[model samples]
Target: MALPNRLRRLLLGSDPRLARMLGYWAATCLLYFIGAALLILQVRAGAADHDSAVLLIGIGATGVAVFAVLVRASIVMGIAPSTLAAWQALFAIACNIGAYVVTGPLRGVYLIFLLVVLVFCTFSLRPRHTMLLCAYTLGILGATMVWLVATYPATYPAYVEGVHFASAACALISVTLLTGEMSKLRLRLKQQKEDLLAAMATIRKLATVDELTSLANRRHMNEVLVAQERRIDPAGQPTCLALIDLDFFKSVNDRYGHAAGDAVLRAFSAAARSELRAQDVLARWGGEEFLLLLPATTMTQAILVVERMAERVAAAPVAEISGGMRITFSAGLAQRHDREPFADTINRADKALYNAKSTGRNRISLG
Candidate 1:
């Protein structure tokens, strides 16, 4: 238990992603350990100098410590994680090249580290940066080979160095070029994933929202009713409901145009929404009809809310219509008691709406 908690704290401080980066570095550190062991073996066989090996290994160990400080500083300075990762790859490349320069007769084996660095860069950096790093690696390794031959012909011959440089160039260049294409493919797939997620969000809005009134449509209203029903059962509270219909709505479309009727509908929705509390939900049931839902409310409170809706609609005129027309609505109010299903309350409200229409056009009927 102690070990798990400590590990959790180390890996999941403020950023778990940074922990992942540290884990990647830990994995690569195994290569450093393996290279150190090989260096010791080369020293014992007299193929490499002990002092030069110790100096290079010391530098590599110090570079790892510097990497930790730089990463910590990057967080304080608000550096991006990807950019930090690129810096790590570059630092490792430098350390690997330094080792190759000092390793003498065992330099051929150390060249594998450069190939590993190229692979790491392909994932951590951009394709362009990866290509540049690959080119840089090839150039530096080639230069190191030429310098060793010129300075120490007894230990390093030009003919042998020429063949080694040729082989390293072909292998490193081939791997980098192939990995660059893979990097491009990865970027394209990532963009397509973002596009697909955005499309899904738009589709969800279309499914539950009325485009004309910009209000919650019937499907969404039903879901809201079910959710409210669940809360009411446990809380022992009443939920108020109102089914509203605009009086003489078809006449507005006939007298003016359908466009003007749309404007009137939009205006009514806006006015009613402004009169509602934050917890209240008002959705378009169909053409010129809306359902207003109030969670944890009594009949008296719900009636006041509906009254305010009526007053606001009367004051706000539809600009698209001639004479800046105002509208009136007939509403049927119902209250759902604790443990009562929403379907029963909604059915009663629908019947009461029919009564409001029969009695007079613009009044609220209680059921």
Candidate 2:
């Protein structure tokens, strides 16, 4: 048999963290590949010593692969996702700066390549972590500048100064591009999440709440009542039920209109909801009728609650109608004192409600 949508989502589509982890790992691997390839090409092109070129490429590739593995492992162990990404970016920045320190930033376009990798790392990581990594990177660059000025002033002569300036420009440009892309992606993802939550809320309301009265609907009520029955003590404490019916509800519709009737219903619902205890479950059983289930309440207590609610409804003014139509409700209370079936309890409540209606128009009765 085919799985239901909810089951499918829970089983196959709900693991967001896995996607994030895998995506990050894949991007890291891709960056490593690009950086390694560039390093190999750069070394070969600028090889005053051919043997050094092969050795440099092999060593750089192995070190980067090891770093990638360590970063991924650390993330899998116990690190927070954002923190892991930040550490990964920091490691990348450290690698780049370490290369610059060893191989002279004046090496034709090598600093530019390192700058690109640094930008990639910054953009790929979380914002606060990225900032910290950038600060560390800038510190490395500053230290490198100071070292060059102090020790190798002649090495980066007037000709090499232009190369260094161009390298800085490359770094700035790369950072700007990647930062812009990352920001846009973040905004899109956030909006998508908000939209998804709103849709879920709407779906939940449709499933569990009455559209007009905004009370728990029949389905939700059934779920709650069944769950309550499982935990209810038959011989221990009483379970009370209140069946409420709006008096002259059909006349309200006939006198004013359906819209005015809706207004009256909403007003009564609001009042009844406010009067209910936090533990009481209120449900719209059907049109013009509502049910309140109160566990661990005696028949007397339930009748008192019903009387108070009836008075409250009688006092609360209905919303504007064509005529000044007053609104009132009749309530019936029933409590299970001994072992009794759920249906019998509800039937007793209905009988009490009928008695309330028969005795007077607006009053409470108990059975």
Candidate 3:
């Protein structure tokens, strides 16, 4: 039968592991139902005992109903997936024990079901919990064998029961060791996948971000410029590019050492970032030179933005540059020409910046 929508969603939520567990349980239950029906047909034909066939069918139906209730309760109560899996394992063990009691320990094939349950638990349960379940299963099987021998001594002799017990114990131990190894391998692979993702993130950051100033690096800036160029249109608002150069930056480094120069660069980058709009792209073009891309802006607005940035940098002296040494920058603004190549646009800005430096420092010039 199909599950209700709400219950189906609860069992098959965002976690794939939970969905797989529920799917496996449903399939196993269906198989058990089919097996019990076959047993009933055999009983009708006098190939199997009628009482055992009836008992098996009853147990299978009850087990299915109980499992459905447990699944619903776990989802409704927001039980942890691992905890739910543990509960399911315990229920499976109980069902196996019940089946063994009905069919007699020596004749029952329920130990095969127990092995399958153990294998399923290995996927969701921890190694210790799986091991504990294995121990519990072995204990239950051993106790069932002793009880059968004590009650039906003629049918289950001590020597015969001992051989069966030894064989079952060996099989359980082998499966436990195998599943434990498989679990360890799965965990290791999961860890490796996580590590690989972390490394990829680090590499991407290093490729696009400047180490010294934490601004977008030149390569990334060029890519951004190209993307903006493709988006430009004569009918839309104009795009502007600004080339900024730190005035007398070499002197700062030569006078105060490279460390102080680095401090100044970082301070300037931070100040410019704080003053600019979120849409503006600020990148370190090279030593002491930064590029700013302002989309949907005119040349006049770009100039005003650069002038404000210059004021901010001059007002806030770099702390590391002893004696509160002040810093200034010269910028050149250029409006992107209709369908013009991005490189040509950048060249125009660069020329204007040179003009600003040659004419005077700490001012904005239009290209």
Candidate 4:
């Protein structure tokens, strides 16, 4: 069943809170078994009567077994960790109260168990919930104190019982305040960490990406080129670099406006992107100029790819740029040589691009 599988996983999983809960359960069971044994020993030695011993041992054992079963069921049912902790704290308080009543002659020792449970709750429950549990605990202990004084007026005087209650209440309130502050500090630190991570991500994006066109900037493209060049081998597939310049880009800016020029650049980028493969890198090299890096591509293949892109750019009019204007670009592509620097290859491509511009525009020149 799903329940069994979940229970097994919770028990075997590496979640710190769940592991701590299991340890808490085991410690409580061990304490119950120890208490039960002590009560049996006391009965045998005649230090305690049979009825009292049976009452204490029977209630403790039954409570421990029931709580163990509930813990497993809670895990199987996928109860929230905080809810499970609250339930455990409540169960511990109930057992403490029950033990106090059953072992009335040994009530002093039982109150220690109540204090221990309060301490455990401080760490496990939220501040508000822990405060509420403390109030409930104080109320029950106050009632038990009243009952004890009534049952044995000679032993537990009113003044002595008042002092004991006051001391325990002070201890509970101190722990609650301290733990509450710690929890708040922890939450603040976690939020700060997340905010810092978000800021770092924004900074990284700005450093590597162009703000206008959402493409890799010149610096990032240079890094990519260097990395690709290092990967070159004599037997491996070749890499090609292409430099693209928008023909008469300044005329569009002068005739229409800078906004129209910006629009045309964006339109050209979008059109060219569609013609390129996913692995191809496109970067805005400078004003009105772009760089394209084609990995595992030959000179012929890179030229064909650029030719198709140029055809597309010419056929399509950039919408809303000077009331829909057709534009073109000139490109020069060069393949990387064995052990050659990327700067040399880029220089050759730039020279070829100058030749393309001098001869005419709207064409690609291979170097």
Candidate 5:
């Protein structure tokens, strides 16, 4: 058998934004570590000339690794505060600028780190924090470019001016594309949340409804009765309870089978439902049994209503079942009185129904 849906979601799935952020950060850190190690190795090959620089680069690489580990751990443990995430972003940008200064120029490869870091920040951080971090990153990148132009004029020689200009253009384009992608992700997440809520509401409604009869089931009737009781104005209105039991229902099921019995039940419910007024509530209480709650109705008024319902059920013929047999119901009606408990009223109605069933099966009895 397949795994349950919730288990699958828990074990094999992740939030899209978080997954993207994790991948971007993991790849970026790995690349930076590898690049830094290569640079240190090259300097070590010429250690006689660049001993101090080689040692410094190795230290910076180790620092980056350590910071990455700390941030990853905090996020995994759900302990990374928003303020700490902002500080981490600022620190990473500062370290990037420091690396460029140590190397005497800003290489295009540094842009890769900046772009990856920006994507990761957008995914991991909130909108306000991510934008603030983005601003800081742009500022640091600008400063690094200015430093390169001032300290290493030949690095951006005027003879190849277009190359330097084109790199800047590319950086702008990358930032634009990444921002649009983030916006799309946000929209998608919002839509997913709405869809989930709608599905849950539909499921809840279906739980309280009978599939075949389209009537309120037992559980739903109980809930509605309690809610109505709480809303009852003790001085202004009265609520009546009625128990309706279908007569000779088992005979129909025994003769025509369950499918035919279902059809007859549905037909009876539809006919009975048509006889009810807007202020009344009806539910399928159990097999061959139904309950009705009539608000602002007295015993006489409730009897008339129950009699009409009984007449409707008795008159309605269920075709394609039991030689098109006619169905009949017996109902017992009781009205709420001052100082009477709700449960007691229901018991009185039930007793009235028992009396009605004993006297004859196709009429309404009042208590």
Candidate 6:
């Protein structure tokens, strides 16, 4: 395990994808060794000449070294691994076919290894490409069989080559079809996994976001406040909370339609978002009421932010179809005391908000 890990680091650098593809490349190189061994075995059986087997072994060894270098270079250059793997597949098929043509009486051994080529391709190539390689293998081997029967009828009888070709074709085509089905299954499973992840993300967004205003909903805001309460720092800048209520919002719905009332709320939320600082949070606290959280803000700064938000709302027509009526919200601000419970600070702000509503509709009051 340690040696393979070190080899992967040295050869493939740090990319796990590259390392996996290199493993496939190594298997094809191993097939080259197996082919050479088969040929050497045939030489000992007197089915192929010693000189021919030795020469082919040397060529196979050199081909492995060359492709290893090419694979290493492709990894370093960030080239697509499949592209080089395609080239290696072609090289392997050609070498396997050459070995089959030379191995006299024991050439059928190389036909079995041709199926190994298709298996390699099932992992490395697209299904269609693998099937295409299968067809190429059939065509080339058919041609070789015809040539062998004509040139060396004593060694490769016509009926013998025919049976060999038929058997090899059956095995190759069967594996190709199986690999095609497997590839589709793998693709379908991957797409379903992606869809599941996306649906989970949508569920999370609906949990946090208000349906109408797209602001944080009440439950999510409470979670934020609870988190904020846990991390209060006395020496750090103060945090402020403001409870805001839309003035006469029920009357607006009574005068105009609910659609116009909804439009006003949406437009007001948009404006509030634009006016608030990035660190601030505003939540829709159910039906024309909202809570604003201003981190690192004093009461004075919170009041200024609330006042600016009020002026911005008055400057724009929140509901153009409702005679372009301006909207106003009364707010009450409270600077959070160190170690004070968040609920108590909110209660003080809510109480002060009632005072602002009782005195005048558009003004802010500090708690």
Best by lDDT: 6
Per-residue lDDT of 239-303 in model 6, one digit per residue for the tens?
99999998888988888879978988998898888899999999999899999999999888888
Q: Worst 10-residue stretch by lDDT in candidate 6?
A: 316-325
- For model 2 the local lDDT of residue 146 reads 66
Selected candidate, larger TM-score, 2 vs 3: 3
For model 3, residues 1-367, the per-residue Cα lDDT tens digits are: 3568677676576566556656767876876765565565556666556786687678667877776666655656787767877877787777666655555333446667777888887777777778888898889888988997899888778887788778777887888889988988888999999999999999999999999999999999988887876774667788899999999899998998899899999999988888899889999999999999998888878888888888888887676777766889988889988778879998999999999999988888888
- lDDT of each residue in 105-209, candidate 1, tens digit only: 777887787788778766667788888888887877888878888999888889888887888888888888888888888889989999999999999999999
Cα lDDT of candidate 5 equals 0.70
Query: TM-score of the candidate numbered 2?
Result: 0.61
Q: All candidates' lDDT scores? A: 0.82, 0.70, 0.81, 0.79, 0.70, 0.85
Best by TM-score: 1
Residue 46 error for model 2, in Å? 22
Per-candidate alpha-carbon RMSD to the true structure: 2.4, 9.7, 3.8, 5.5, 14.8, 3.8
Q: Enumerate residue pairs that collide in model 6.
A: none
Q: Flag the better candidate by TM-score, 2 or 4.
A: 4
Off by over 4 Å in 5: 1-168, 232-235
Query: TM-scores across all candidates?
Result: 0.91, 0.61, 0.85, 0.73, 0.54, 0.82
Model with the higher lDDT, candidate 3 or 4? 3
Cα lDDT tens digits for candidate 5, 198-315: 9998888788997778999888988887787677585677789999898888987888888888988898889989999998888888898888989888878888888888778777
Worst 10 residues of 3 by lDDT: 99-108
* Residue 228, candidate 6: C-alpha displacement in angstroms: 2.6
lDDT (tens digit, per residue) of candidate 4 on 1-367: 9999798786645565666677788887876676666556656776556896687677667777776666666656788767877877787777667655555345456567666676666556777887898889899889988987898777767777787788778887777777777766766787999999999999999988888777789999988987876674667788899999999999989987888888888878878888999889999999989999998899989989899999887776765564546789999899988767889999999998998999998788888
